[model samples]
Target: MLYVFLSICCSVIVSILLKLARRYSIDISQAITWNYSMAILLTWLFFKPQFQNLQAAPIGIYTAVGLLLPLVFWIMASSVRVAGIVRTDVAQRLSLFIPLLASFLVFGEALTPLKIAGIIVGFAAILCSIPWQKKTANRKVISNAWMYLVVVFFGFGAIDILFKKVAAFREIPYTTSLFFIYSLAFIIALTGLLIRVFNRKARIVWPHIMFGLILGVANFGNILFYLRAHKALASNPSAVFSAMNIGVITVGTLVGVFVFNERLSLVNKIGIGLAIVAIILITLSQH
Candidate 1:
């Protein structure tokens, strides 16, 4: 449970840093590029993963995750900036519904009654969490923050599915696969950064590098601690799953509302509650 607590902190801290990036004028692209560098370094240092099984690795899934990670990360950053932490986190946590749906629709798994109920509630939660911009007298509604939230919801869910695919591939050790995926992701991110620099749309700023290093630590810590929690609670996988999702939403809401003073509509509040209930149902269905 301690690992779960730390993981929750790291997850929310990542969002807080992303929220702060806007105020600091940080180039999220550059920061995200450098973030993979740190992740690569830590993965190698901590896991000491072997690359001898590269030929057996699932390159297709690796490539997909490599492409999506930075893109979704930037979108999540934009979401935190525009939509506020409360709604963005709720949307993210509810994304678990995607994999559950995939089990039924794509993998031919039977859907239990609880899963069906959870899916219904989870869909409602997503709709409620959308940060709908109110119409002004001039009707000049400018914020498309809800779009970012919607993208984040689906994007992370896709990433999660890819990760599960990687995990199921037994030819390569999971840590080694992770190391290779991070390497590929770093290359992809670096390529995008170079293109931006070439186009004169961005520069190699020092602040982004520093912030990226810190963000990478928090991001990696979230993964590390969550894995630790699962390993420690191997007999009860549902506990880890439910605790992580519920914890992030709970902690993120408190920080967003109290520390950042983020305001949520009554409907959004209802969405957050439904999100928790949906996760509970999903976890129960697994049992």
Candidate 2:
């Protein structure tokens, strides 16, 4: 339970850090590239020996996970830029329903009435949270970047489902799988950095770079802890993941309101309520 709580807290911190990174004029792509590099290094330092006994298939699984890291971060950051944090987050969280459905249909996971209710409510909340409006006479309402948010939703949902499927395979240690994935992500991201450097646009702001490094360590720590919790409580990892989302949304909302002074409209307030209810339902359904 403590591990679960800590994992949720750490995940929330990732979002806060990303928001702060935005304030510093950081290049999100460069920061993410560096972040994965740092994560791979730190994870290897702590867990490299654990991989010695793993079978080959888990290595491929981990590599797949690594390939997803950049896609997830890039789309998420673009979503934040286009849709604002609140809406972007709501969409991201609600997107987990896709995996939940997949778990049921593909993995024979049972969906209780409460889980179904939660999914419906969560989806409704996400829809309510979106800020749709007509374009002004002189300005476009929805930017092209908003498409990235949709990608974030679908891509991340697929990633989560894949992770769960890999975890269920049981032939390899979870830590071994994670290490391979992070290492692969690092290689891919480094290649991207090299390409960017050749383009002469790869400026590394030291502060953002260091922050990304710290965030990388923290991100891997969260994954390590969550994997532990999932191992211990394998019957319902999705429930734990949903709880983490609740923590992220709660902390992110507070930061947006008090720290960033972002305004919440009446619709957003209602959406928050619905999101809370959805999380509660999802959690309860795990029983």
Candidate 3:
């Protein structure tokens, strides 16, 4: 339970730091690039993942996750900027449904009554959380705002599926696979940063490095604590899963509304409520 609480705090802190990035003139690309460096360091130091027989690893999944990680991360940052933390957090937390969708449609898993109900309610939650008709310069800009939210929804969902694939690959230890993925992600992010710098679109600065390191710490802590929570509750996996998804949305909502004064529509509030109910149903279905 303590691990769950710490993981929730770390997750929300990452969102808060990203929210503050543009305001503080931080270069997000550079910061994200450096973030992987810190993650790699932590992985090496704490996990001590050994790189034995890389040939046996699922290189295809590793490369795909490496490509998608930084890309989806950037999209998430954009979503937070456009959609606010509340909606973005809800969409992310609710991404667990993606794997379930895959299981039913692709893997031929049994779809019980509770799973069906959870999916139905989860769909409604997504529709309500989205800003369908908001005032902007034009309809396109309005669409663009909610578009980030939608992409964040599906993008994170797809990433979740890919991560499950990676986790299932028992050829290598999960920690070793994670280290490889993080290393590839760093290489990809650094390539983009260097290109931007060469094109005079960005520069290497100390502030971005500092912020990136801090962001890395929060990001790594989220994974570390969540894994710890799972290990601590190995007999009751449902508790950790439910607590993590629900906790992030709950804490993020409080911080988003109170600290940042983010506004939410009446429908959006209802959607958040439904999202929580949907998660509860889904967790119960597992039991």
TM-score of each: 0.96, 0.84, 0.97
Q: Please provide, for model 2 over 177-281, each residue's C-alpha lDDT reduced to its tens digit, 9 standing for 90 to 100.
A: 766677788788778878988899776568767877877877877887777787777887766766777766776677667876555668877887788788788
Per-model C-alpha lDDT, please? 0.91, 0.73, 0.90
Comparison by lDDT, 1 against 2, better one? 1
* Candidate ranking (lDDT, best to worst): 1, 3, 2
Which tens-of-lDDT digit does each residue in 1-287 have in candidate 1? 99999999999999999999988999998999999999999999988998686787778899999999999999999889878898889988988888888988999999889999999999999998897766356544547888998999999999999999999998788888888888898999999999999999999988999999999999989999999999999999899999999999999999999999887889989999999999999999998
Error (Å) of candidate 2 at residue 214 is 1.8
lDDT of 3 by residue, 127-226 (tens): 8888776645432344567788888888888888988998898878888888999999999999999999999999898999999999999999999999
In candidate 3, the residue pairs with backbone N, CA or C atoms under 3 Å apart (3 or more residues apart, or in different chains) clash, namely none
lDDT of 1 at 149: 88
- lDDT for 191 in candidate 3 is 97
In model 1, which range of ten residues has the least summed lDDT? 133-142
* Model 1: per-residue Cα lDDT at residue 220: 89
